[model samples]
Structure formats: structure tokens, C-alpha cells
Target: MSTDRTDCLFCRIVAGDVPATVVATTDRAVAFRDIDPRAPLHVLVVPREHHPDVVALAAADPALLADVVALGRQVAEAEAGGQFRLVFNTGPEAGQSVEHVHGHVLGGTRLGWSPG
Candidate 1:
């Protein structure tokens, strides 16, 4: 429970500075519901430590990066339909609102191929 990012949205959510419907949490990570859900079941999984973005994860720790992906898959499999789409929007063009690194687990319906 560190308030590393005073401006990062995910940091705020994890620190209880911002309210969110948390789904799951671990020693190093936390998963919560996205306010403006792009899909029926939209869960945002973020590391407890502040990571600028996915690129940061690639350079910081390979094992941590893998754990994030593995967790996403686990959440997807546990969904009602046992299927989900994982998304990591990079920059502004990619629709990344918060700079903090996070993965979006979208499920509960058929997802289209195009971006939203």
C-alpha cells in the first residue's frame, strides 16, 4: 500500500484513494472493475508497484511480466463463460487513460475484432 503515483489512476485505486469494485488481489498485484467498462466483464489488473506501462514491464522483470499474463488467463478461465480478451493499451493512440501499467480482462460476450 504505497501511494507512489499521486496522479496515476490505478495507484489511487489500489491505495484506496479511489473507489473501485475490486475482484481479486495478491501480494504483488490487484484486480478491480473498470468504471467505464468497455466489455460486459471488464477487470483491470495492476501491479502494486508503479509501472509506467507494459514496455516498462518488459524491461523491469520478465517473471513479473509473465505473472501478469498468467493472472489474466486465470481470471478469464474463472469467468462465467470461461473466455475473455486481454488488452494492454500502450499510449494515447491506444486509448491508455492512465499511465500505470495494467491489463484489461474483458469477457461475458462475443468481442469484435476492431478496437473500441
Candidate 2:
């Protein structure tokens, strides 16, 4: 997978080329608030390095993938009382709008199961 894509939105955010409501960061990951939040606590945890999707990230760097998830949990604990749902949308059909691999941390309220 590519390291950085100049045209990628998340890459721009990571590079400080674009502004984001950053919640947290680590050597391996960055967590920021989602523009269109689906929940009160809607943060996205992304690896500092670029990877097309979560599967690519898992295959190329499992540790980085774990780092992303760990950051997501950290954000959840701080923002959502330690309970959250981590979602990785792999493709367009799966609701992945950006190419960069990210884990959506959703919580802050009682969640409902309506994946339609």
C-alpha cells in the first residue's frame, strides 16, 4: 500500500494540510472527530501512515492496526464512559467514503441496532 496520497482527505488531515477536530494522537495513530457524526461520540482513529483500508492495514502492519484500535478505545473511554463500538468500513458497499483505513469510535449514548 502507498505511504501517503496527496489527494486523500485523511492524508491531508494527517499532514496538517487540512483541519480536523483532533481528539487524540499517538506515534502510530491519530484520532479526530468525524465531520458528520452518527453519534454523540463519533471519533475516527487512523494510522499515521497511509493504508487503503483496514484489511490492507491488517495485512501490512498488524501492530499499527492494533494501535489504531487501542487509540479508538482510549478515545471512547475519555468521551463515552469506556463503552464504544469500533467500526471499519472496508469498501464503498460497506460505507467507506475515504480510502484511508480508520476505526469509527461511536458511543456516548445507548446504541441501537439499525444498520440499514
Candidate No. with top lDDT: 2
Provide backbone clash counts, one per model. 0, 0
Worst 10 residues of 1 by lDDT: 1-10
Off by over 4 Å in 1: 1-3
lDDT of 1 at 109: 91
In candidate 1, the residue pairs with backbone N, CA or C atoms under 3 Å apart (3 or more residues apart, or in different chains) clash, namely none
Question: How do the residues 22-99 of candidate 2 rate in per-residue lDDT, one tens digit apiece?
Answer: 989998899999999999999999998999999999999999999999999999999889999999999999899998
Evaluate all candidate structures by whole-model CA lDDT and list the values in order: 0.82, 0.92
lDDT tens digits, residue span 1-116, model 1: 24488888888888999899988777777888888987888998888888878998779876777877777777777773668888998998898888888999999999889856
Candidate 2, after superposition: displacement of residue 107 in Å?
0.3
lDDT, residue 43, model 2: 95
TM-score of each: 0.89, 0.96
